[model samples]
Target: MPDSTRQRRPFRREGPDLRRRELIDATLRVIASRGMDAATVRTISEEAGVTPGLIRHYFETKEDLLGAAYDQHMTTLIEMSQQAVEDASQPAVRRLARFVETTLSTPVTDPEALQLWAGFIQRVRRDEAMRRIHRTNYHSFLSCLEELISGALAARGRRPSPDDLKRLTIASNAVVDGLWLEGSALPEMLGPDELTSIALDAIGAILGLDGLNDDLRKELDK
Candidate 1:
């Protein structure tokens, strides 16, 4: 462990949100490495180098802490796309490509992200807060997707129907989800090159990028 982590192990912050954030991060690190069943308050507190009581101080139950961690991770992931979409330098197509790349590329494509996501997704069926967070991120990224798709299509004077936009957004999100999982599960088997080729081909076909110059195709492939 680094000295910074060593010094911060006690996690004795005065603010509730700050303390909760620390514990939530601890929950992620622990649950990401060990399975969720192993993520007791004792293990998480030990991971945070704080006491189990501290977890209860913020979260009434282990489920609450787990939900908070899931929320934080999803918020982080959504904000990544927000930042990428803020880049005004690229054209709409390239910007869309960058958004897809940011979504499907590493550390987001790492096993830790998928493991944490799988844990949270399983819990969502039972946990109301987790379910809300699930819907929140989906809607949040759906808005971003709508913007990207609308911009890319409108640049060519085509505006999809609201229903079509909704369906396409979900499909695009599913494509990213698949790429993320495949990369995390079989980085060696699929490799980034193969993953990129397959993903670009699929997304391009879906977005109607079937015809373009070699340069633009290479740009999208990038």
Candidate 2:
């Protein structure tokens, strides 16, 4: 039986972008806390405080929403890393050093973040859409690293050719990725300071920018 005048509540309207972001954030949280298997539309809707219909309204399928969530996660990580390298006042070498430092530090190198990444990475191979998103984000991050490396090399008056720049970027990225994984997975064993120091040393050596060690020491002392 329906009440004649029970003061029915009106639904609050949210912008499409806001709604989508909320859903994506909810998906990431669910995946990070539980596993990807637990990130169903019903679960995500509950997390976002929305109706399951709303999720279907925003996304055609569960896979689409998962892809969007992965996209948001990777975009955020890349933006944070890019922002770290965007200090115009600092020289290129220092900015590059900052990028390394930022990537190996909190929020970016977090355990929950690692969990979210591990969850999505499993789908990256078998899922075509997820694979595309992963490839796009990987290149985006790599491009950022390449730009920083180019600028740092130019600051040292050493202009690497296109091939050399690509190689340098790949090698530097490998160092950062390796350390980021280890630090995120073993936070107790690898503190931020140690992670950044090892990353800068290894990357600096590869780039022939030995001065990076001194730069890092100065930054830490500050």
Candidate 3:
């Protein structure tokens, strides 16, 4: 355990938004390294080089701070995935491949991220605020993925029903989520690049894009 006294330092006052973000980040770091039980206002204040009173000024309660942290975590994941697929220079197939690859790679595949997610996911079962955050982020992730799938299918001159698109999106999400869980939990089991390749192949098979899979694999080899 860190010495709280030594951890305390002069707090630099900032604008409300920046200070709030810093506190939320501190809360996440504490939760990830020390567990959720240790992320009280005092601990987070120490982590942020501030006082408990300052933390309270930003967050009315500990649960509010926690909810903000979880929301930022989920927002980052969604942003990265969306950015990967939004590269207009890339073909639809390549964009889809990049989305799968990015999701299974760093930032998302980090052990700390997995730890934070695991810790907050349990609270979702009992915390209404956490549950709402989880549901909103989850649906946002799915919506982005579905858009990518539809674009890729259209590029191939194939039009599918809404039901088919939903099914494909769910399956594709499962593939990425499964690989992400395994890679984050057991990094030694597979190399990062290897995990990415496997994800691309699995997603290609799901969407019946074997040719694009070959292109993606070859591109990675370059």
lDDT of candidate 2 over 1-222, digit per residue (tens): 222344423468989999899889989999999899999887787777777898999999999999999999999988998887677788889889998999999989999989999999999999999999999999999998998899999998999999999999999999999999999999999999899989989999999998786896787699
lDDT of each: 0.76, 0.90, 0.86
In model 1, the number of clashes is 0
Instruction: Judge candidate 1 at residue 183 and give its lDDT.
Output: 90
Which ten contiguous residues of candidate 3 have the minimum total lDDT?
1-10
For model 1, the stretches where C-alpha displacement exceeds 4 angstroms are 1-14, 211-222
Badly placed stretches (over 4 Å) of model 3 are: 1-7
The candidate, 1 or 3, that scores higher on lDDT is 3
Rank by lDDT, highest first: 2, 3, 1
Candidate 2's displacement at residue 129, Å, is 1.1
Tell me the spans in candidate 2 whose CA falls farther than 4 Å from its real position.
1-10
Query: Could you tell me the lDDT of residue 71 within candidate 2?
Result: 95
Better of 2 and 3 by TM-score: 3
Backbone clashes in each candidate structure, one number apiece? Answer: 0, 0, 0
lDDT score at residue 194, model 1, on the 0-100 scale: 63
Q: Write the per-residue lDDT of candidate 1 for residues 1-222, one digit (tens) a residue.
A: 222444335434378777778889899998899888878888787778887787888899998888778888988987876787697767777677667766766766777888889877888888788899899888888889778877877776878999997887788778777887899887777776566556666777777764322324577567
lDDT score at residue 146, model 3, on the 0-100 scale: 89
RMSD of each: 3.9, 4.5, 1.7
